[model samples]
Target: MLDTSTDIRLVKKAIRGSVDAYGELIEIHKNYLYRMAYLHSGTEDAALEIVQETILKGFHSIKTLRNPELFRSWITRILIHISIDFHRKSVPSIQIDENLPETRSLGISIEERLDLYEAIRQLPEKYRLVIVLKYFDDLKQDEIAGIMNIPRGTVAAYLTRARKELRRSLKEGYLNG
Candidate 1:
């Protein structure tokens, strides 16, 4: 979670031409940004590129930010847009590396996790984005709507549809397995 007052101060300094302030602000949110990017892009390399692009774009346009308190959402909006665009222009692929260390701590078996990931990957782009932002990123529906530039109702609808689809897909996987 961001400290709003500190973010406001850093945002002000960054807007006023303080490179260190901008870097520090970005550093605070780098892991979060990468997670969002990785969830959206489905690849470490693409996620890294998306995060770098988001940081650069944020740096260039920090002065244009109207509310410093909303800096995290603002940068996140940029990352989401870049990720959506990147996905649109590229062929979609899913690569689940079973040996990844993060898989061990989730309590769920790796096979189950991989099945869930595959199910998520099979969802439509809008549904997938909603799932990633809402569940994976732990964003509220209103925040997701804001970041995704969609209505709150639409976000809710997407979540409903996405969850339904995930259930169907995962159940089918279980049956087949």
Candidate 2:
């Protein structure tokens, strides 16, 4: 991971049209962006496309970025916009069946995990987003608020409500047999 001062210097260089500096900065943040994209899109292919698009957009707008220190949040904001657009333009896939076979990947069985993801997927957009950005993306409440353009207190409220809804959904066996 690049230090803040190094990131700031790279951002400065990138803004001056230094492609190498830009590339280095992107490489440093690539994993973070990929994780966010994968969680948002729920597919490797889509996530890869989002990451590529994000890099392009970020590179193009590098000059407009006012704060070099906020590069991660700025790039992340761009990604969030692109992700929203991607989801808006794409057709939602219909699941034909809910019963999942037991298969372990990364030490977690598919049958057990699918239930959780299914429940999360069913949440209303606002609640689902807060949950995903908070837990999966590991973003702080303030960061989530900035991304969602909501107040910090609202983000907290949404999280509390989202957790409650998730608990109720899980308890009802909505996603489980």
Candidate 3:
């Protein structure tokens, strides 16, 4: 397997003018990109939309990116931007705690996992985005910062806030039950 850094180099070259190189880069990162989208969007349709749009924007804008080694984060940044655009145009509503399940079925209950995803979805977008990328996607803080175009400190802050909010949400769930 090509090391990730090696792949980035090839992708950079392809983005400049080499279609074959760009194609190879896409082949490598497409699955990861889709997964990242799916995790954040919480629906297959939105995830699929982000993935398709991200790839298209990446091709169109790749030449403007200076660091070839940062393609994963860069592409993710594009995906986030696309998602933000969609969110802004989406129907607005008051922030109510959304309905959730009560179990998580890995020997846990289905309701637990549903509750988890529901709580996560309730997080303010910035905090939720960081948590999803950091925990669900297993990305490092630095990488997340790059992807979000925020400082590492900001990413840490968002993560802290997200956890606190999630804990409170779950506590409320317990109380209500």
For each of the candidates, give the backbone clash count: 0, 0, 11
**lDDT sort, best first:** 1, 2, 3
Q: Give the per-residue lDDT of model 2 (tens digit) for 1-177.
A: 235788899998998999999999999999888877766676677778999999999999999987777788889889988988887776675241343322223244566466667677677778878887887776789989977889999999998888888879878433221
Q: Which of the two, 1 or 2, has more TM-score?
A: 1
| Runs of candidate 3 exceeding 4 Å displacement | 91-108, 172-177
Between candidates 2 and 3, the one scoring higher on lDDT is: 2
Query: In lDDT terms, which candidate is top?
Result: 1
lDDT at 18 for candidate 1? 95
Off by over 4 Å in 1: 99-107, 172-177
lDDT of 1 at 85: 85
Candidate 2 residue spans exceeding 4 A from truth: 1-3, 94-109, 172-177
Q: What is the per-residue lDDT of model 1 for residues 1-177, given as tens digits with 9 covering 90 to 100?
A: 257788889988998989999999999999888888877766788788999999999999999988778888899988988987888887877575554323214356678877877788789988998887877777899988988889999999998888888888887433220
**Winner by TM-score:** 1
Cα lDDT for residue 41, model 3?
65
User: Which window of ten consecutive residues has the lowest lDDT sum in model 2?
Assistant: 94-103
Worst lDDT run of 10 residues, candidate 3, spans 94-103
